[model samples]
Target: MRDEQDDGRGAALAELRGRLAASVAVARLNRTQLAARAGLGRTTVSEALSPNGPVPSAETVAALAGVLKLPPGELLALHRTASAPHVVGDEGTVTADGPGRAIEGYSPHDLEVHPAGPGRIASGCGGVGGAQELPGYVSRGHDRVLAGAVSDAAAGRSGIVVLVGTSSTGKTRACWEAVQPLADRGWRLWHPFDPTRAQAALEDLHRVTPRTVVWLNEAQHYLGDRAFGERIASAVHQLLVSPERGPVLVLGTLWPEYAHRYTVLPAPGSDDLHSRVRELLSGRTLPVPDAFDSQALAAAAALAENGDLLLADALTRARDDGRVTQDLAGAPELLNRYHNPRTPAAKALLEAAMDARRLGVGPHLPPAFLTDAAIDYLGQTDYDQLTDDWAETAYAELAEPVHGKQAPLRRTTPRPSRRSPAPAIAPQAESRLRLADYLEQHGRTARRHLCPPASFWHAAHTHLTHPDDLNNLAQAAESRHRLQWAHHLRHRAADLGNTAALYRQAEHRDAAGDQEGAEALLREAADLGNISALYRLAVMRERAGDRDGAAVLARRA
Candidate 1:
């Protein structure tokens, strides 16, 4: 029997490793290259291939599948060969005649992974680990939030209570700890994204033995960007507020930075959709300990259950160096180390990301924008391969797809709001269209993969004949979250006597606290028939107590 089991496990590993080896070969990737694409370290991939290397976790396998363009199901199948059933708390024994078969552990209606990229696919998100208690699974303030969430679910009083914090703060483990106590009380996790599963769960509530818990961790994908994402939100809402509720608890977690983006609407105030989303996310939002030390590191190792062994080692090193501070103050430094940029391409990518963050755009640094920065700093290279593999060194928690080809993401860019009655979308679309046309006609650059206008930076340097083209390019830069790039283009346009560009540059300068520079631009813009610039100049003149000049300029209105 033991030989049979070993033989089965060996065959599974061999097959899975075979597939992985084939993918790397087909892509012509070395250890470093393969690691970068799979979002793992070169060492992790190396170990998986080595004879003595430990079995890779499901998350590792899944990430490789995503980067290799292999089927996720195959990795999941491979995971089953190595994965032992996660034991929740203590194994429970069934009554002699209750089910006719002996069962161990309080089975919480048997929770399954969600289809929408469970585990690391959704950026460190997961359903219950079935209390497998993967290493590094720490419970901070566990009793406070988990107990409350479970109680609410049992009583049907709470609609949704999220464990909101920055990434890797042990939010998921806190939740599992809370739910484990109630496993025998009829609390099963139900994923409502599938239409069929959703309907069945909603209809068959009476037949449910324990209550149901809809674990909605790192669910920004469903709420923020795609239309289908909203469906998941709606289904969760139905379960939450369902008139026929029977102890069905809705719990979730989110990065606080994304709260407004997902909860609020672009249209302002409160609309039905916004209200619904807001309500779905309402309830007790418990804060995790958010501390990292000896305990946290151990918890992380345990939580990973597998693939995270390499990461655990890295964290241990960081901890030993005294670099891993108590909280996120040392995050950037730790991130830099974790990125471990050995190659020029990898170093450049890390620098670009760190630069953006230093410049205050790193929090919202989209993958495409990072690619833009990389090309600007490193010249042209194969970023598609780099980002797929090793970008995780810098972007440890990329909640969204790195390719940015998933769907129209909800951008948090500041735009001209609805006061103008003309939607911001139309003007933005026109600007992009105009820029695309200019790039194709003059530069002869055809855009593909919706890649950035790589030549736009060069165009910004050159003297363009048309003012509209310059201003349009500026807007495109701003839309891409490259504020400095936008300012540079606007300054260039202003030099060419674009009045609107002059005003825009003036605003930029003023916001940047270069008041004298702003005043100079405003003076130029006023001469070019910009009324707002004149008004700004008048205000400045008044502050300097040139009352007569202020009156004259103000009368010009």
Candidate 2:
């Protein structure tokens, strides 16, 4: 008996043959001429363009659009429809008729990867020796999703599951665990969600064997992008509702921000195609949770010790800023300990040390500056060395305060107390007080050797009062690959009316991947008569293919 899949596909080909003949006539060409334009042999084009029983190859269909001047996308849709066993039904639905041979363009090689364990997940990278290896998967915060998918697949229902989360969150692990139980039950796994090849890959998945699990990992570019999202959403809708398209489950993951981007509706109260998918997936959608369980907590603790991003050098070490809290879980029940200085001299010196530590680390402060800041802090607090308060009488017993500059900075991080905050935010450059003053006040050698707390520059754009010092410091930090510190000082200098600072700030921002911010700063500096900024804009315009704009900028420069 002829298979129903073959019959439905035959019907589709009959329709395609008629369309192909019409397209040829529209292009005013016979098979020979069409074959010449398409760069295929006359016989090959004849066989593919035939309106009878034989189906055309996808590549041939792809060629026809350019040869016949038909829209490429329209021909692609037709190719996708005719090549897949899931026959396109009325109104663009994929309905399965019966089992048939896999569609053309679908690579069936290596369809199954041996499972390491029952719940193991495959992360394409980041293994022990950097070799690809399956690891036991943790389905953290996705219990409901895993259960729903397992229940639905076991019941022979086909639908889409979208797992949304931020970067490095375990969306892949969760979905792998969701489909693990089905893997042993003869369901084949396929990935149809590659960002660069998303729409094209979907055509391949459409032709795969029935009872397959389609993984659309990180599919935000396809489903969330404004330009291509609607077409993808329509494709997904058909994949879900078409009964003829056998029992296949679609698994996908995306960032939450991308997910929300597609929530826009087409009209008032009417959901758009992307929104429609969310409606279809009503209860099955899963978002990665911020909360953690005991097992997750243990795993996170382990990762904290061994795992880190590429910026390993940027990481700050743990700082013990004099406050002490202890929890020795295995110790005696009544055991307790307190941390504090025992002597008056120790207390005074320790307080000053804490103040010094509060200063920034990248631009280390010299001993002279730290000594001044510390002594100033002590004086403001009325910390006298005598009788626990500094007085003229105690000066005889205690030697004159020596600077910490002689010793390398053992600590650079300081804690924020209720009374004081770090110099994370500073005031205007024209303020009466100045943070860069601390970095200044000394000759070039002292300025070069010491780092100042951010607060030193904050609450005042010392650049207004100390432009020469800031320019030197910013350049030094930039040369050391400390772009962040350099950018901070340049920002203050720019606020202090330094047009050169604006251009430098833009350059640093561009290096740090803030192109828009950099461009904005560049424009500001260009308007402020910075020739370097104008030259950079000209180079940028030339690279962006705005030749006329580049010429204009170059002329201005």
Candidate 1's displacement at residue 384, Å, is: 20
TM-score of each: 0.33, 0.42
What's the lDDT for residue 315 in model 1?
50
Clashes of each: 22, 20
Per-residue lDDT over 222-326 for candidate 1, one digit per residue giving the tens place of the 0 to 100 score: 455343345555556655554444345666666777776656556755444545566666545666544555665666556445665434433543445322222
Estimate, for each residue in 230-267, the C-alpha lDDT of model 2 and write its tens digit.
55566666766766565677777777776776554567
Choose the strongest candidate by TM-score.
2
Off by over 4 Å in 2: 2-130, 133-135, 193-195, 201-209, 225-227, 264-281, 299-415, 419-557
Q: Give all candidates' CA lDDT scores.
A: 0.51, 0.51
* Model 2 Cα shift for residue 38 (angstroms): 12
Worst lDDT window (10 residues) for model 1? 431-440
**Quality of model 2 by C-alpha lDDT:** 0.51
Hey, what RMSD does candidate 1 come out at?
A: 19.9
